[model samples]
Target: MTKRSAGTTASPRPGRRRLVIGAAVLAAVLLLFWQRDRLSPRRAPSEDDLLAASPAQSAGSAPGRDQAGPKPRWVGSKNAGTGEDAEASARQIAEKRLERARHTLEGYVQATRYPPGARPLSEKPDLQKPHSVAKNTLPLARPDHKLTDARVTLEQDRLYLVGDEAARLVASCTTSDGPARCEVLRAEARVPETMPQASTMPPARVAFADEGAGGSTIAALFAPAKEGFGGYHGPIAINLDLRIEGEEGAAQFNVVYTPAPPARLTGDVREVIENGSLCLYLRLAVDKPGRYVVVGRVDDAEGDGFAYLEHNDPLGAGAQEAKMCIFGKLVLDERAKSPFVLRDVEAYLLKEDTYPDRELVPGRDGPFHTTKAYPESVFSDAEWQSEERDRHIKEFTKDVKEAEGELEALP
Candidate 1:
């Protein structure tokens, strides 16, 4: 063999060193990747991810999971008008608002409490009165005719309407009440934008009867709208002629006035009637009368009933939630004089004061003495049983005629 060069000898040093360095670099790259992954932010799983992971979990969730999130739907743009213009969008919004307001007002009237006989004095006779008027008039139309505003008039101790000009007095008639001649008028008018002052004097007596089924009747009088302390100088007189009827007996009633909170007077009266026939006729004059509400209810065993004389707005219409109503039943008449005119007929009825059967009451059954009304039905079972005997005791008091002379002097 030919003699080889000295440098040509196989040298493992450079090759081995190169192999070691390559292995070290590969290990370092893996360590860097692992560290980076650990330091990175750990994002939570999205709904889609969760759903995909477990079908059982997704099924157990509330219905409409996909629909729960925000939807990308078309919305009416600002300034949009009719015929594909921005003004149309604005008009749509306004109409929706008006509809909502009307529904709200209707509810309020349904729930509103009105005192008996308290006139909406000095108000327009053509407008709505506590006893008579169009059912559809609360939020009066705005002056521009585009918006709506509720109006109330206190002329002649009566609450009148004042909204649209189309509403006006239409007719009137005269009637006879025993020897005292009376007038019965039917007026029509529009609702105004605001309410005027309320009458002071409330009705003396309120009776619910005569209407068979699906009918009711209400009548009341109030202090003159311009009258001063008494009924002498008050404003125009106010009256309500409400009528609703049923088959066997018509439920005829009216609201009375008292120096009590309007809500209390209205809410409490209806609640009280839920327990009995609510036949007590009170003729007490108020001490300091401003504005008061009167509410009434007539319910028999079948759950069919009628109510009227409310002072609250949107009477009988309210949220579904339970609410605490005021308790303002002052059995002790505070008119300084005898509050009731005890005629022989009234005396005869008083003498026969027997306890009403439990069937008369809605919730309370069995042979329990009728007295105070229970709280709303949401009370717990334990709570209802706790106060049984004491419920009727407080309201069962004797009627003593101490102020007979004052009652005899009435006109």
Candidate 2:
């Protein structure tokens, strides 16, 4: 419900969806850096513990639910317990939280190696890894605000390349009340700090498809050609006006994103398995190169979710390679299909660590197809192993041991 302010990006604030599952429980004990290892005198987890805390295939499942354990008694339940029972209930709650903390730590340590782009919901549970690769994208959900009748949220990358042919921004709208209506009154592109350039596309009528009882929704896709970018490589500010039922006049909004210096994904690709991981090597033609991060999604032959791929590396100018890999165990554990279809491929030049941190590489939008279906048998079924994994296991085991000890000492 937050409206865009002048000179600022029109996007959702951070932490829209719930934090990584059980992140809060482990937040107190999980190490934020690789150098610090907290060893507990309590000893490492047993083999049975490892088996119980095995990685889950479903990305959305809670961290500790991979094994059968006590369901956490979430805080603030109505009439949680009475005098005597209250004490017991409180103790039970504390024990369950400790269990979750242990399981959550294990979850992070045992997660299969995946590119930052392919991170599952629960990946990076601690959210403090300095080396973690984060994607620059619009908020996935609408932000909380006072707007009661209607709300709007954006669905797009935070940056676009001037040569991307066209930059597309999708606006999804919904109403809290009954069947709601929405429309795009005006959409225009321009370089900021000056007069708004000519409207890229004529104002068009946007129809909100009413999904009976569920709610009415609309998608306003604004894809303006390269000319609309005004030959600028800096921040491209957008002015958008929309008419929603129950709102007065036009709801004016502004958005800001950078124009990435141009680059190309030369349509050359190769797939191979290296060190218990499946990698897709994408060829690129570039005049300028810095730190680049490429992201894409894979689906099985049956169109089931397979894996997410990401490549973050510093590349030299000229014909370069971007290797995106998926952990072998993730494929085997999920029982993924052969002949994976790669789509939603996107690459950007990661700039300074700040707002609008990336510039997109052109011509790599839409349902991008990376490679044809290959035989599934070619991929190894072994789980990925690494020195890093071992280190994490060593450290996180201490966390589990400490939590277990806490539970044992309690009444």
Per lDDT, the best of the predicted structures is 2
Candidate 1 global CA lDDT score: 0.25
Model 2 residue 359 CA deviation (Å) reads 1.6
Q: Model 1, 79-196: lDDT tens per residue?
A: 2235445444334433443343343333332222222321122222432222233432122222345432222111122122111101122111111211111122222111121223
In model 2, the runs with Cα more than 4 Å from the true position are 1-101, 110-161, 167-228, 240-248, 253-260, 363-378, 402-411
Instruction: Give the range of the ten consecutive residues with the poorest summed lDDT in model 2.
Output: 128-137
Alpha carbon lDDT of each predicted model: 0.25, 0.54
* Candidate 2 lDDT over residue span 1-411, tens digit each: 867788986544457424553576467556543224333212223323533553333432223332554533324333334556655755564565566667656566455444344554234343222112333322112233333455555444433444444334445555555344545555555555543433433333333233333333443343333335434445554554555564523332233433445467987887786766667788998767799987776766687656766788898899999988766666766777666766667777887876457666754434455455445565666644556655655655765676677667656
* RMSD in order of candidates: 29.5, 21.7
Pairs clashing within candidate 2? 339-373, 339-374
